[model samples]
Target: MLLDHGERILTASEAIFRGTGTKLSGKVAGIHWHYGTRSHAPELTAGYYNTRFRDGYLPIASMFARHGVIFNFTCIEMKDWEQPGDAQCSPEKLIKQVILATRKAGVPLAGENALPRFDQDAHNQIIRNANLRLPEDSGNTTVEPMCAFTYLRMSQHLFHPENWRLFVSFVRKLAQGQATSNSWEQEHRDTDKFVHAGGPMVQEAAALLH
Candidate 1:
């Protein structure tokens, strides 16, 4: 969400293009921050993880937020940490980093997605700081089974637009009372079957949605 002087504002793709996490533009604010699930993922530079986060990532997030652009971030921890550097920071810490950076820039958190869920306190803090509501805990248990499969895809292939589309749609269905335990189980089995057979799992999932 975008805001001016604490009041809501409508921002379209054109205005949001600057915040889409690709490039930096003087005319736009906000930064797109993406991270892989593994520790020490090589998508960014090597051997300077802390520096990159503090000097590069946080600064960019801060700068964009100062100008009323929300710095969107996506981080997931789905597996064991592959490096000590990755283990040094908890998911909560990372979330705090982003929250702090954006707050410093005087804007609300643009958006954040953390797969497999974080600790309850982290969730609460996010909700509090971002002024967002959360799904009821009782409602969450029904969808817990799907978290692993979802985390698998997000960890391995979330950067792909098609995969993200399928994942988001499936999650939405779960949230909207359109999904059931049996259906999610079927979807998971179908995904596994298709992926194992080297088929396009996302497209297959889309067909399942219909």
Candidate 2:
């Protein structure tokens, strides 16, 4: 846990991007930090194993939050991580919880993801069972999973034209030069993945963003 002014303001894994094991914004002002998720395919960088939305989505979002971008957001993690589910209903309960949490905090929130179920331990075993090639995204590209500091994604109850437009413009700026390769460089150097952003969620938000 991270503290500021003697107050517990940040959780460990959620502090950074969850799956990517990224660091977070160092703030404890009780302000709402924003984040995003479920936009692109996993990056298979050296040592960097990019898990799908559920595994590292929250951590990635936290990275965005720390950068003074978006603060309030959520992603759904389903019960079975192996079987891919619809991003919309993957983590139904988690979506609701994040919405409630953000509202109680009185902050703006965005939901960018699909709902999917997954079990970490079971999935790990399955990786070997299925003989799936493990892609690492930490040092030199592979960042291990950091479960403690993950941010969750939520669903949209209503659509706001103005907000969508603003978000679209924002993501377009971030996505300007981002791609799987750029993300690979950042991960390999142990730099910052949040700096390099863009995905389906950003694109969709842009289309809706006025």
Candidate 3:
């Protein structure tokens, strides 16, 4: 039923895009689907996950691909299960499965963080997922990097001195496509000039947080 509803929406969207004859026609990027591990029953096991993929997500991915749509997912920072008992229902496992499905379907895959986290560990996990560094993706030449990534939320907490510092480092590493050994002090120094020069823009961003 969910798949049918989604197909109907996509069909309508396709008609609007192809028939509009406007400059923005056919410019839709794709659709986003949020998959949460907690949404599954606790009793579900690894076999259930496999079946869900084979019967559920894989077909959905293929359908989206047929409509020339990208499949973007969330909670990418949940790299693995924290509890050994919950390993069977790990979000990372599902993420990897979806990645392979999108690849097979010939659709672009993108992701976003599930929660707001400014720590290095979370940043590293997101980077790894974005780059498809998992064992499943290893040695696969056809595996493509994520088309994009989005930070989950914006709040005053994100502008705190420490969080802002970490964010700057995170963005720098992502932009450069590699890690850096730069300390927080160094990042602060580098961003000082930009902050000073773009005071108005910075103020505007702060205003949005309020």
Candidate 4:
């Protein structure tokens, strides 16, 4: 959810949790640089970080804790500062800013991916390790799996009625508790009654769109 210095966001989140009958698993709080771009001024960035933590983050965190919601806070680095109209700053500096603020606020840090070239396996490991140590060092560690997609593409064929039919049928079967097997092939058969490597998976995704 978007961070705001208002009570409405908290109340609305609670309402949604109750209404859906879905258990609240975890919360991912994201902090972004001002105006969607990195700030070059050190003092400005520091002030913004301190103010946001005190006014925006802390109270909401308290509310969630009162409601028994486990969460982790994260920051999004604007890696595209190399592009036009963006303020350029080092990824290391941006990361430091976030960690320091969350540390002071006594909130657990959430794992995040930013900075294009720094998303490699080694860098990811560093993030995971740091999060794991949070509980030991600060006694505040509630990290959740953060899924980052580097590649995703949508096929136009999914809009076709024929394609959507097969996809929907597969999902319907699953919703009816048909796919009990753990194996992919067996589950697909139980869900869709067919499995073809050429692209049954793609078709199944389209079918559910209807």
Candidate 5:
């Protein structure tokens, strides 16, 4: 909705939550922001992290919390306070920025990646080792496992450094293997269907909590 409407999903959510009366957000909740390139183009531009955030700001975070919207931005970064331009954002810096922004906006945040997952023991352990009871309002503070920890770790590996070399290597390999394999038409359709079906895996991953 935020993407289609171009702004204000968060504010509206808060109003809805307040009107409906629900507790804000959740302990295991998380958000992801995609940065860098979406495709190969003469000019590389536009992505979740690079996209302007001032448009919606914290209304989404705040509203989601007020109404118990657990996770958010399934594929966008929470962003941080820095330069107005997207060039300044990095994965680590963005993480810090999100932590600050979410806190200020009154919703604690985390870097969440979907499963077939990664080990989040570091993130969870920090909270657990502290042995915190749930926040009076929050119910649970544990960063419960959404799936195997490897997915999260792998996601970090894929995006944290913005693995340009890996991407380059892939392109080089594809270019070298430029011969298109002739496949039956039905085979192509079947492959497309299987690829599109990964969406269900993602939803199932989100539903998983340990």
Candidate 6:
């Protein structure tokens, strides 16, 4: 069913472009998939992974690539489970699977946060994922960085004084370059301390400058 939906979208897009006499060469079209991890019992993880990827994403991936559809995925900020017992279906593992699939299909990739978050940790995770810095992808130059990244949603909380400050810093870091894991950790620590020490008034005043 999902595959059929994807095909219909591609077909409709082609038709629209043809009817409007618009060339599709430079046009961008994408399909967004929400990343999901099965954290069930370890015994069931393999089956779930195969069903979700092999049957679900893998088949549609090639189809999308053939139509020049970008694979824009979400939930990039999820962390891996530390417990060995729960490692089979960790977010890291699931995200890696998606990355490999997209790379194999020769599709351009993009990402989005799963939720609206203003913390440095979440932003750093998004940066790492977007840069394809996963341990397995390290030194693998063939893997490309995300073509783009979208923050999940805009909400009242996002505009709060402290949140706004952190958000500005996050944007700056992203623009700078690909950050190493150590740099992300240091930034997380510094941001935590700063947020704790800053008062509401100070944060509001600081936000006004940016």
Give per-residue CA lDDT, model 1, range 54-144, as digits (tens): 4334555555554555455544222224224533444444544555544445554443434444233333333333432223233343222
Model 4: runs farther than 4 Å from truth? 1-6, 19-21, 24-56, 70-210
- Separately for all candidates shown, the number of backbone clashes (residues 3 or more apart, or on different chains) is 2, 55, 0, 4, 17, 0
Residue 138, model 2, lDDT: 24
> How much lDDT does each candidate structure score?
0.39, 0.31, 0.64, 0.41, 0.35, 0.62
What overall lDDT, based on C-alpha atoms, would model 4 receive against the true structure?
0.41
- Taking all chains together, each candidate's TM-score versus the true structure is 0.33, 0.21, 0.73, 0.36, 0.30, 0.64
Which scores greater on lDDT, model 3 or model 6? 3
Candidate 6 has which clashing residue pairs, if any?
none
Query: Least lDDT summed over 10 consecutive residues: which range in candidate 2?
Result: 27-36
Candidate 5's displacement at residue 83, Å, is 19
Ranking by lDDT: 3, 6, 4, 1, 5, 2
Residue lDDT tens for model 2, 35-127: 123432322221112233433333433443454333433232222343344433233333433333333333334332233212233222222
TM-score of 5: 0.30
lDDT of 5 by residue, 1-210 (tens): 433332355456567777665644433222222333242121122322223334222554555455455433221212234224544333433343344345446654433433322123323322221122323325544433111111133333333222423322222323333312446574345444544555465445435522
- Worst lDDT run of 10 residues, candidate 5, spans 40-49
Candidate 4 lDDT, tens digit per residue, 1-210? Answer: 233432466566677777666544234434343333333334244333334223344454455455545344333323435434543333443444444544444444444433332222333333333433333245545432222222112345543544534444433432343323357665445434433433566656666754
RMSD of candidate 5 to the true fold?
17.0
Best by TM-score: 3
- Residue 112's lDDT in candidate 4: 40
Give me the displacement of residue 116 in model 2, in angstroms. Answer: 11
